[model samples]
Target: MQPKKNSIIKTLKLSKKKILVFIFFVAALVASFLFVLKDIPESATIGANNYPQSTKIYDRNGKMLYTFYTTKNQTFVSLDKISENLKKATIAIEDRDFYKHGAIDLRGITRAFIYTVFKKQVQGGSTITQQLVKNSLLTPERTITRKIKEIILAFVVEGVYSKDKILEMYLNQVSYGGTAWGVEAASYVYFDKPVERLNLAESAFLAALPEAPSIYSPFGSRPELGKKRQLEVLRRMEEQKYITKDQRREAGEFQLKFSKIQNKISAPHFVFYVKALLVQKYGARAVEQGGLNVTTSLDLDLQNYAQASVAAEISTLERMNVTNGAALIAKPGTGEILAMVGSKDYFDEENDGNVNVVLAKRQPGSSIKPINYAVGLIKGFTAATPFVDEKTCFPNPGRAPYCPLNYDGKFHGVVQMRFALANSFNIPAVKMLKANGLEAMMATASAMGIKTFEDL
Candidate 1:
């Protein structure tokens, strides 16, 4: 009886081994299918206007003044191009286990998952590659679907690319602060140094900037919060043995050589051109994610001139009880907006941002008359097309009588379409719209880029 019981136990143990082996094979096959080793896809493409690189603002002679970009707005470079300190600082802060992982670091993922699942708090355990992917390709909006995709892609990128290649791509594509992509851009914009010249303290500081860009970017409008974050980075660096105790002490006390935000575009209206391009090309997702690189037709020289002219007008308006003003410049034929100055300065001081004004609709006043004239033009009403320019009482066919007046508060007699529109005579527009029989004029305006109708 004892020998028979022992035999039954041995049979059961052998059966369990076979079942476990089968299960392992099934999981391996599924994982293999999910992350096929060949033909990796480019994560997300950062496109520019007409140009392959981001929309670069050039001078009349073709010098780059401002560049619109999604991430770093530059090429993904090789690791050999970067400094050892930057590599160390990034690996120390981002992913200490990058050399060993398949796109997904299961241990880190497990740790983060367990903590969040049990503690119910926001935490980030993503590798540097994951962060770079999120910065360049994915939105920050938290979702399970995005996480799964990120892990799969990370594993695939890791298998295909070398460690240095991944780090180089990460450094170049990551965001440092508001519209500042890549560590090199941040270096030029902030400390006025190149990425290669960044000291350990500065490199650590830049690494810290991504955790909460708007709040911790020392170069941005806010410095107090940035200082606090710098200290936190120092502490973490020490805890991770990235720096010695003495190194941490020295870095903690180190004064970051930061600078104020450069107000490049004096033109408020040109901000609208970029915003419109972002909305048109990348959609609302890219705009909100700050991953859009816009290459525009704007000439910095022309934009600066326009911004100065418009600002002067705003100053004059303030004296007349008008505190706000806006302006725009568009390329001919294509109608691509070259420059848009949104506000005198709308950058947020609190969270470090501002709303764009050029896209915002203000009362066009006489400016709207141009659209109506455009309508008349489309209806074969050339500049020579004659129309009555009388302010004579306007009444609906069977409705209340109304009257429209020109800015001069006087009526122009009969005039040609060219003279009426070029002179911006308001009464002619009202009469023209009335004569075009309302419905046809409405259709014409809709076809000619007039968005919504409020006062129409």
Candidate 2:
């Protein structure tokens, strides 16, 4: 009977120890909760000043022609500008209970922790707000202190910003793939268009990029993995009721047409020239990060055609030892540069394709004859007037005698001004220049937009 009593007393002692341990656990949890709550701000503000955004270069029709950036290629667009499908897809895949969660998804964190610790399966428990806090304000280093701060900051951010605003900030701040940051730039880099125009399938495809940008990039070696991720996103969207069964099936089966990788700008020379002009006008920093939306008078279609034409002509001219060529098309009336082909191929390093031959100085050959004869006409020389075209030598003051001959090697004894100018007769052109006077001819050429003879 005494032994039985002693056993009961031992049982009571064990119960008391368990109760104390429970109270200690509860106290510790409350203290941690208070610590996190105290650090959270009442309000939060997100601004573009936090990072550098690429200055977008667009054609007159609002088509994205090129982007100028240092490292990260991003163009921020409002949440309203993004496609509804993309928003739904992102939420469905990244965080289903994003709207219902407070600052942190406790359930998701618990599950992820269990999976990471016991199951050895890595999973992210971060909600979109937490991700935004970590990506923008904090460093990428994974630590207990950083994570705690992220959770606290995310809670503060949600309280300050509306759900729509928070989602908008997340969409704009997240990296899509490669160097693409935000939906707008990703849309252009992937679909070659605006983010608002993306379809359901495209949206799903893009939503999957944030998981592992390089690993799921269509341009990368593992394109199939990207496709699989996209399908998973669609499945999640369907499960969330954001998309119907048929819609998910159709999106899953949709053939994705990716935009060709534009490693260089469409019109490299023209774009660079525009960049230089912008830099001159708005300093380097402003041009790079001031988010200047530049609309130039370039006709992209005509420019492409002109580039193709130049490339074709270069191929044909290659046999004649012409390694490269350049072409420029401009309106005679308005002087609007319609197209500027700097070289045959901008990537052709062997031929120095980057050099703008249109700006290069070379002998004008017979091209200058028109200007000289036009000056002669201004000096009262009529087209019907005759001039002797012969292999004649004119006495020079200091230099050797200036001899001029016909290109055909046979001189026509007499030629009319029209025939001389039209046929580009060198001897007649020299005489016309002499008649007009050097200073007057130079002034006439200058007035006609011949910049090469400025010193002369």
Candidate 3:
């Protein structure tokens, strides 16, 4: 009787403890719900233009170079104006379950949480609605509190707006690299066409950019990566049944011709160089949207003259297979850039004219002969030092012997260093390099501001 009575009391005590735990859980849940509810923003104000003002760039003479803006470049279009292909492509790549899920994807969030905690990889599980809310209403902070607020606002926004409205706003508010702020702007920027005219391939290409504008920009460094990303978007679209397999194959094989940048700016490469510096100093957000009035040291008159000279020279050299040229004029005393022409023409995309060749790494060819001669002179080799410019091979222990030949494929025997340098003889230069020692030449070049050479 006593043992049975003790068992009954133990069961009653366990029931009381379970009830208290349930009550505490419920109380905490109610408190958290109320706390987050107060932070939710008004969903009706989502369409309001809250973007910052444009930053103006000017030359030293106060002439406007460019008006750098993210929002200023935006051209908002109705959802119907945008291409259906682009819409499908965006949905396929960005969020496959956009239509099926609510404001937050619980399953995706759970998976991301598992990856973050167990695999030690932080990942985002934001739905389209959540993204719209975060980009429009919240700061770009990666914090638990901020994420909680983003989730709350996403729910409120979904409740107030339909899915179509949310998608429309998102397409308008998202950035698509450079000064492009919306799909309409991106369409024109990349294809030189309206958003409605983007075909399946073009639409897929643009759809790939919003994931990372700088990385996936066709005009950016490593453009092959952008092509790879476009193919990935097409793959996703096919997997989700948004695009057929044939359409995916065709789109993947399509050659995309990007439009030349058409922003109204003077000395575009110089302007961009200055903008890059500014972005480095101030954050990208501040430089693009902080309304900064930047005055550079560029002389517009010299810039125009240099551009004309380069164009004329390149035209003259066209028959010689020279398709491009660059020029940089600076004040010799102060080293301030008076004019900088990065290429022969900034608008010639076919010839890769947008590439700033002045900054590119290339074999100096005969141009580096002067540096070689200078290093030889420093190492006690006089101008009259005689080098045999005959057929000779420098020995290598494990590789083929480095045999150098002159540009004209004829050698002049026993030439002075000055004459060999003047004529730019390859054999004499190689012989001089061998005598001067590679380490000694590299040290001299480094001191003379030749930065491209790596440690041997």
Candidate 4:
């Protein structure tokens, strides 16, 4: 009886031990669930905004002249809206288990650890959700706290939204470089079309670019480097069976085309100017966060006309080996900028695109004679005032005797203010400045918007 009783007690103890283990496991799982529930906030439900307010520039005609942005707008489209090849290529390139994973992929994490551990290096196992979390809510600076926050937020996002919604958020919020914030913007910049129109080869090419945008842009900037990276994306797509071997070959050798934003008709200089102003107003962060629609004092029709005039002048000066011209036209009465043609092309850096030539100090030649006439007007010299033009000298500043002559070296003796201005005769004007003091002529120049003088 004692031996049988001992056997029964042992069986009961084994059953109790199994029950205790199961209870602990269930408690741990429940505790984890409760903890996750506590950490998730309502704000984590929708996609978090990471981009700053971008500044826009418009012409008088209400056309968009330029856009200055730190990070550009991301055009978000539905999975159903985008091409099938695009969806496949992006999945193949980024995360294959994007749909199955709940914000984080445990299997991927384990596999990555196993592979990289043996090789003695760290490899990223971040899912698209984790990446999105990092991009949206957290600072890009790598740190333990940031990582923790990212994980928490990603989990919250998974709980709140559907897989397709998450994918849309990721696609729309991703940075594709060159002032382009999303895949759609990148597509338009690279292919002059929208995401829905992206072909298989094009889709693969775009998916490949995100790894290193500066290096792998399809613009043939670093063709060898770009081609290599693009090829890698294509090969990965094939390996993942997103595309077949035939598709991969076709993609690998496809002819790529790129458009130049630098050569746009929009005023690039003015765009930069507005961007600088936005940076001043909202700080650098505003360039991404502000999303400002800047209404500038620029007039498009007047700008075009002014540019045409400068172009005409440049053509005339071609024989003199001059290839540059600039103009700044202000509203006749209000001094508002009617037009400003910085240069011939939007990105003509030599012009720095905005010389604001009206504000530039140039060799006055005979143009400054009018300022002296204005000075004479201020000094009680009437509009019908008269002055004698002769060889005269002011004995000061160690200057030479003034024998002011016209461009043809012809000397006109006696001239009235109207003749002096209309003909631009210099002797009478110099005499007037000499008589009225230098400040008087400078004041007159200031009144007329001539701020600097390179002529004596």
Candidate 5:
């Protein structure tokens, strides 16, 4: 009986030790978490001044070209001033349980973790508070440490600010698209009206842009994508019971007319190009709100002159169906862009006038003939080399033969390399390309600073 009692006592002692170790582990974890939380900023520190400053772009002669900013474009309207439809629409699409949930949604986080780990698909599980913290306080990094910081900051922000205040701050600071920031700015930029004037359909359309501003911008390259996103927003609104099915259908069917871009700036294309470079170097947030004063290599006078010339020339060529034109002038010695006219008229929305044709991909046409001839010259073919310019067809494996023809639809038989190149005969150029080898010609074109030919 004494031996059995001693065995039970020994078992009790082992259990006591295990309990102590578990308690110590939990305490250590709590202490480490507190330590991490101590470094995070309080929500009160984030204010109007914490918002990004406007970046000013200037020409080489100190002429102001454009002012880029979130704050500059933003109008600080109270929650009441903003449309109720926009608020509900944003909540429906962005976060349905925004008011009910805390700073973080446990279910959303769990779902995101499962999708990211087991399914190998990344998903955003951030609440509205988390998004505000990430945009305002945190850098745009995708590291675990950054995410942890974002979550912690979100909690801190929620603890200090009221839910309505947080929503107002978010609506006032979030980027809509292009140079527009916040709902008020977005309203003016997209609808050419005040925030209070936005209808339910317009509100839903605007709400769709915050997820991906550039991709869903109505004036952007894929304009049709914005409408698709708008429909999704309307559907979400209906599902959340924020709107009726009839309202959703009406909003989806509503035809929206986007405001035309009327930016008063010199050298629109060059300014945007330089802005892109700055964004690449300093990040989009910094370029838009860092108060950077960028002095570009563009000459304002030269840019104005070039723009006028291109517009005049395009107008005269309207009889021939040439409705748009672009011109880019650069200095010979330093490669400085003196002037860049992206289109005949930057405000012509019907003809896609805002597109920078100087940087757009296009067939070189006869302009590439010089490079072909140059390649031929390098590959033991001289200017006096004789080439038959008769009807010719290059063979293609498993495809129809590529037949070449001259611009005049008549062949000049037995022409020299110089005459064939000078006249821009298509048949001779094809023969030159075939003789020089496609690989050799492509390499030559790449070497001559034609980057688009490398992939071909």
Candidate 6:
């Protein structure tokens, strides 16, 4: 009986060993399948084409005066192009164990999953590589299948790219509010300079933007939340030994100088007109999304002078009941518009100040007289040819006779073509147009770059 009992126990132990061996074999098979998946080449390249960059608009002098981009206002920069302070701040705030972890942090994921499942709290455990993979290569739908793909792609990206390269890609691909993408564009948008010029405090502020760009944007309604996030980044940096406590405190107390809001767009209306032209030429999608570089004939110095002059003139004209003014200066030879002032102020929404008068069409008033007289001169009417600015009525089909009057409602009899156009005598200009014929005058105006005229 004792021998039989020992035999039974031995048999049960042998069965348990077989089950454990089978489990180990299945685990090895699953891992080998995952390894095969990782080995398969993916189509997405880690290159500059990952995001749509802004087509920088430069003045003739090569000064970047404006930028054009769609929703994802990305500007790609290498890791070395940014400051070390910014890099450290990003690592401190985003992934404390970045260098120490592999492609994924199993321990952190476990902890986070446990907290989420049981404690009703959520936490992130993804490494920097994971984030890069999720943002650049995968769709944003949160699902088990997508998560699995993210992990696989993260491992694959880690296998292909170095740690530093991955870190740089993450920095450049992340959004930082408004139209800003990447650290360089964000630095310029927030601080109006390159990332290399950022201080510890500014770097901390920027590092805080990636999590919630619009929410933490300094221009948003909750600016204090942005400051709070910035302070948290500084605290993390100090805790991680990237900065000393004193350095962190100093940075925290530093008065952050954010670049003035979106209004810094120089020559706003002119830039918009250029954008419209580009859209017409390249189609809206290509101009907005193709990352084109446009060099224009605009002269910034001239534009500044013109804007100043118009502003001064508007101040004086306001007393004369003129609430706004616009000016355009063009090179006579090339017809290149050198300067354009669209309105008295772009922000004065009450007066419709944002409306660009240079592009708007109204009755030319006496301005059309020059074209009429020029046509008359081209058709045997010399500058000395006589015309009378009298109260002569033009025939009307269904209404009272069409009579034109001068500014003073009095006519100067016997005016030459030059005098009629120079002093803008209304009846003489109308007679000149009639003599030259309306079609001939319209053709002459069209030849002189006046495109707004129509048959109506």
TM-score of 5: 0.51
Cα displacement (angstroms), candidate 4, residue 285, comes to 4.3
| TM-score to true structure, per model | 0.49, 0.81, 0.50, 0.60, 0.51, 0.73
Candidate achieving the largest lDDT: 3
Write one digit per residue (lDDT tens) for candidate 3, span 1-456.
999999999999999999999999999989987786677677778976555646767788987677677746665678999999999998987777888899998887887799899999765688889888888888787878778888888888888888998899999888899878779868867887779999999999999998898998877778988999899899989999888999999999998988886666789889888888999999899887776889888999889999999999999999999999998887877888888899999889998877888778887788888888899888788999999899999998799998999989998999999999999999999888888888887888889878897545
RMSD each, Å: 11.3, 6.7, 17.0, 7.7, 16.8, 5.7
For model 3, the superposed segments whose C-alpha errors exceed 4 Å read 1-27, 49-72, 107-124, 265-456
With a 3 Å backbone cut-off (N, CA, C), the pairs that clash in candidate 2 are: none
Candidate 2 per-residue lDDT, tens place, 1-456, comes to: 999999999999999999999999999998987875565433344544457888988766776678888777888888889999999999988888988987789998898899999999787898988888877877788877677878778877887887888888888878987788888888889988889999999999999999899999999987999999999999989999999999999999999999887644778888888888899988999888777899988888998999999888878887789888888888789887778888898788988888888777877788787788888888888998899998878888889999977888879879999998888888988888788888887788789888786453
Please give the CA lDDT of all the candidate structures.
0.66, 0.85, 0.86, 0.71, 0.85, 0.84
| Model 4 TM-score, all chains together | 0.60
Over 4 Å off in model 1, which ranges?
Answer: 1-76, 83-189, 192-257, 261-292, 348-357, 362-364, 377-382, 387-391, 397-400
For candidate 5, the per-residue lDDT at 113 reads: 94
- After superposition, the stretches of candidate 6 with alpha carbons farther than 4 Å from their true spots are 1-48, 55-70, 95-125, 139-147, 177-179, 211-252, 260-268, 298-325, 344-354, 380-404, 408-419
**Model 4: residues >4 Å from true position, as ranges?**
1-5, 23-48, 71-155, 158-171, 175-179, 183-265, 273-289, 301-305, 321-323, 343-360, 365-371, 411-414, 443-456
Best by TM-score: 2
lDDT of 4 by residue, 204-290 (tens): 877777667778775546667877767877898889877789989998898877667552446555556667677787787666556
Candidate 4 RMSD to the real structure: 7.7
- The weakest ten consecutive residues by lDDT in model 5 span 45-54
In the range 1-456, model 1's lDDT, one tens digit per residue, is 999999999999999999999999999988765654233346534211121223433444444455455543433334565656667767766676778776767887787788799989545689877776676656677876677666667766666667777777778777787666677667656775557887877877887777788888665577778777666677767777778889887877878777567724333345445556667976754554443344456667776676678668877877678655556788889886666666554453442224456666667677767777777777777888877777577766777787777777876787898888888887778887776777776677678777665765
Residues 411-453, model 5: lDDT tens digits? 8899999999889999989988888888887788889888875
22 in model 5: Cα distance from truth in Å?
2.5
Q: What is the lDDT of residue 439 in candidate 3?
A: 84
